[model samples]
Target: MSTRHVLLGLLASGPSHGYDLKRRHDEQFPEARPLAYGQVYTTLQRLVRDGLAEVDGTGSDGGPERTAYRATEEGTRELSRWAGEITPPAPFVTNEIFAKVVVSILSGGDPAAYLRAQRAAHMGRMRELTAVKSAAGAGLATVLSADYALNHLDADLRWMTTTEDRLTTLTAEVDAA
Candidate 1:
């Protein structure tokens, strides 16, 4: 994920201090990893340096003064362009499981056993995600993110099953080369 872009987008909402930006980011993107305070400040500094953001003002609300940031006109344009752009679908398969299976075959190890263990691990994660998605009061963002992950896990499980069924052929092919 583009941290700078995300921060700019947040600033587009309004001028906000680093603490407020970090809080809003977590609340807005519950599925994403939480941003660290240092990361938020660092990204904010870079955005200011790049002319995408500027310091709006500094004020104290009963404590230490904090600088608030706002997106510049250029930042707004950039954010709009990024939001409209399409994310390209993965063009190549980088299946670590497949690589491991081939490696196990080449090394005289039990590929079937490895697949079984991997499948079990995937199932466990799916169950956890399912529970999160099904929980009452789950927001749309949370549910959607969980669904996205579940779909990928399902695809991987299907591939693992198919590969296990074809282990004999795969083993022979690997042995030949």
Candidate 2:
């Protein structure tokens, strides 16, 4: 996920201080890993440097003065373009699992055993995610995130099954190469 775009979207609501942006981000993306304060400030600085955001003003909120930021016209246009664009699926050909399987075979190890281990690991993770989803209650963000992960794990399990079925042919092809 693009932190830049996320901040831009938040700023679209209104000008906000760095601390406020961090709070809003956590509220909006409950399932996401928490953002560090330094990361928030760094992203804001980059946005300001790139002309995507500007420091609107500074305010004293009973402590140190906090600078408020607002999105620039260009930033809004960029955010719109990003929102409309479809992200391509990640290439599975270069995945670490595939590499590990091939390496195990080349080194005269049991690729099938490796695959079985991986499948077990995936299944364990799926169970954990399922529990999380169930406990998420009605939080759409948490449920959706868990669902997304579960779907990906399901696809990976399917791929592992297919690969195991074709291991003989794959080994032959690799040996030939």
lDDT of 1 by residue, 1-177 (tens): 898988888888789999999999999999799999999999999988999899999999998999999999999999999989988888786789988998899999999999999999999999999999999999998999999999999999999999999999999988998
What local distance difference test score does each model get? Answer: 0.94, 0.93
TM-score against native, each model:
0.68, 0.75
Q: How many residue pairs clash in each candidate?
A: 0, 0
Report the Cα lDDT for residue 8, model 1: 87
Pairs of residues at least 3 apart in sequence or in different chains that clash in candidate 2: none
lDDT by residue (47-157, candidate 2, tens digit) is 999999999999997999999999999999989999899998774478888899999889889999999999999999999988988983648878898999999999999
Those runs of model 2 whose alpha carbons end farther than 4 Å from true positions after fitting are: 61-63, 92-96, 116-153
In candidate 1, the residue pairs with backbone N, CA or C atoms under 3 Å apart (3 or more residues apart, or in different chains) clash, namely none
Worst 10 residues of 2 by lDDT: 89-98
Index of the highest-lDDT prediction: 1
lDDT of 1 at 127: 100
TM-score for candidate 2: 0.75
